[model samples]
Target: MGGTGTTGTTRRISRSTTAALAVTGLVTPLTLALGAAPAQAAPACTAGTGPYQKKVEKFLGRPVDGRQSTADCRAIKAFQTKHGITPNAGYAGSVTWGVMDLMTKQKAVGTNPNRDGRCPVNKGRVACVNLTLQLSWIQDGRTLVYGPVPVRTGRNGDETRTGAKKIYWRNIDHYSTLYNVPMPYAQFFDGGQAFHQASVSMWNPPGSRGCVNMTKTAAKKYWSLLRNGDDVHIWGRKPGT
Candidate 1:
């Protein structure tokens, strides 16, 4: 309902933090603040260096229980190796950890992206893609998230989905319908979905199907700026401009 704000995560991502939760229950929020950092220098969530991977290692120690953590990446590799589970390549995501949680623990990773604000992208039918719909809360001005975000996209051959409902639905990802997202998290064009990162020229193309796609960075930031009951409107190419 406003502009973009800021905040911080890890279901797991990159070659950093490797602290994994016990496979006994559900995931608790921000419990990996173990070894801990001083405060100020605790690292911004969007500081990169593998995203949540680096930060988690800064706080969590070498090994929790018996898992080994070289850095911030969740101990996916080690755990996978020891327990006979398939080791991860280098990338870490919600689904990765979500699966780990299921095999090791019966917990579901918390969706820290839940927010209390709304995405502000109302440009009156200019034909933009609604890529990421994360926690892009607006503070002032025309600020955009410029960070990680969450969203749902089109399916089948007709990716241009149309509807007006508040749903925290999860079905797409970089592996799914996600193709690309906007950069700098600039929320423009309608109901907070004007993020066009790579392939900038292809945006609003005759074939995009109206769903916003982005790199992990922009997606996560978008999530940190939102809350509940936020109005989200996504429209592009509805005929006659």
Candidate 2:
């Protein structure tokens, strides 16, 4: 049910705005004008303190002073850019902080993501999806077979339904006509929501339509490890969705 959008190529147009002084044969005027022009300054980082400033600082390992600083802005901006957040002006707004908070919780999950015993251990080969942390892993009995890798789930209104399901179908080279995008290594678990490889960044905000979007490597691994009829257990709510 979910698919990624293709990125369009950006075409840059360079324009020459220098007017030649024909009276003097020398090109010194043009050279001087070009040299005299000041280099464009970089966009200023956000100066005012954001609502989640302290939280973001703590997450980034910066001093939790509850105020914005130049270093803090740069660090936060780098993180936001890495996660595909827009503007990335280094403002510790709710969206940026939300992503950080989710990461913090996911990190706390550690190596044993299924310690709660929520997913059925005796189900043989099972794929466990933790929507809260936006992670998925394959387990054989009590032994881990695959990941606790990061994933991108459904957005606000189009939330991925949580329940016990089984992999009913699989297509290595799948294409979604509805979304007009490729869904590689597609494995259908629920009615329409499936596990597939997406071109979009997994850390991007909002999230997919209804599918569990994974990296190409993770999807390839899942394609090799899982098959039709494998148990799929999904639980918890995707934060901010």
The predictions' CA RMSDs to the true structure, in order, are 18.3, 16.0
Instruction: State the lDDT of candidate 1 residue by residue for 11-100, as single tens digits.
Output: 222333244322222122222211222222221222123333432232233333322234433343332222222323323333334323
Q: Rate the local accuracy (lDDT) of all candidates.
A: 0.29, 0.76
TM-score of each: 0.26, 0.79
Best by lDDT: 2
| Model 1 CA deviation exceeding 4 Å by range | 1-159, 170-174, 177-204, 215-217, 227-229, 236-241
Candidate 2, 1-241: lDDT as tens digits? 3842222122233433253322221111112112121222334678879999999998778999998999999887777666668777789998988877776666667667799988789989999998988888888999877767778999999898899999887766667766777777788887667899987667688898889998767777787788989999999999886
For candidate 2, give the lDDT of residue 58: 89
